[model samples]
Target: MKANDLNKWLVQERARLIDNYLNLIQKCLGGTIYEDPPLQALGSDKFDPVLREYGWDWPSMAHTMIGQKRLGNIRQLVESVLGNGIEGDFIETGVWRGGACILMRAILDAYHITDRCVWLADSFEGLPPPNEEMYPADAGDNFHTFNDLRISLETVQHNFQKYGLWDQQVRVLKGWFKDTLPNAPIDKLAILRLDGDMYESTWDALNALYNKVSIGGYVIVDDYHVVQGCKLAVQTFLAEKRLSPVLQEIDGVGVYWQVANGTSSS
Candidate 1:
């Protein structure tokens, strides 16, 4: 075989491996590869396509709550950044179980890209009680009351290791978004995924990190349509910044958009 043929074959092989690796990540994280979680009706067809498509039901032992479609959305955005030469790292604020970040890191490894980082910013103690005084949209929110939302930092780190994707390029920013996002070490981001699930959490992420997203990068809102507070925060920030990027929907609940060059707020 000629040298060009060998190179083509190598590229094709790598692509196939990456595809397979990502598919497995989806199944594992979605809990489809395992028996139905504890609460599912015994033998009730463990797979719930509608819930999995929109991430409406949380699998007891799965690493993510965003479901298969949203997870696939993250994969698409991260790959889009790599393909388009978008400069900077990838970050998911409000990371739970670190599934999305794990996938991001795994993708980077498959592509052999070393410069970019995968950052997870989360409280690791679950959502904060709504600060109604400051964020009216979050008033009466009860996410803070859910113990399941509180996945410790140690567990998330273990999740990263479970996939053998933990490495120097994957970092963590632990604290509430209000305290951590403004000081996040990222210089620029190719993808900003927000799953904070409330007005304050969502708004804080955008206020601190949205401008740092590179032009042509992506901003993925995991709860844009499902959570009233999240939706409000997204709309309010876009209006405040005068950014009107066209949103791409993910299973009707999540949305993403590529940043336009001049969309950065002054």
Candidate 2:
């Protein structure tokens, strides 16, 4: 096989192996697996929300919760920005099992791009307990108590390794967003994915990184519609910054938009 063909085959094979592993784990954990015909027919959506979220009720694995539609959008955004000569790295602020960020690295690896980086920014200790005194909306919601939602940095690195995509170009930022994001060493960003499911987490990411996102870059919100606090934070940030980019829905819960040139707070 030609060099390009060889690379393509390897990428596909690695992906298949990982999928099999995930399926095996699901079954081992007594989780029922169901296929969605509509999504399968469309060949877009990957994980069924009903199965992954409720049916499984298991820990968040090193798999995508954003589904196929959102995942495709991430790949397209990366391709578009790179093809258009846009410069910078890709970052996901609230990486779960690091699936989305791994996908970013995989895209770059497959295309032989070495200049850009993929950043996995997360607490790695699960969500912080809501500061009810300040963010009343999160009051009584103990997301931090969900041990399954928290995955360590080591496991995330292992997840990347499973796909043969682990490398120095993949950076991990560990800490709460408020403490870590403001001083993150990211020079610029081509794709900013925020899966931070709360007002404070979402707001901090935007405050620290939105301006650094290059013109025409994509900002994807993974929980914008499903989380009230997250939705409000996005709206408030956009309004405060006077950014008018159209928010396009990626699925039932996720949304994204391209950053227009000169869009930022003074």
Top-TM-score candidate index: 1
Q: Count the backbone clashes (under 3 Å) in each candidate.
A: 0, 0
lDDT of 2 by residue, 165-266 (tens): 899899988999999999999999999999998888999899999999988788998888878999988898988877877788776778888887776321
The residue-by-residue lDDT of candidate 1 on 13-63, one tens digit each, is: 988988998899888887767734533422333557666656777667888
Please give each candidate's TM-score: 0.93, 0.78
Model 1 bad stretches (over 4 Å): 38-47, 264-266
**In model 2, where do residues sit more than 4 Å from their true spots?**
1-62, 264-266
The stretch of ten residues in a row with the least summed lDDT in candidate 1 is 35-44
- The lDDT leader among the candidates is 1
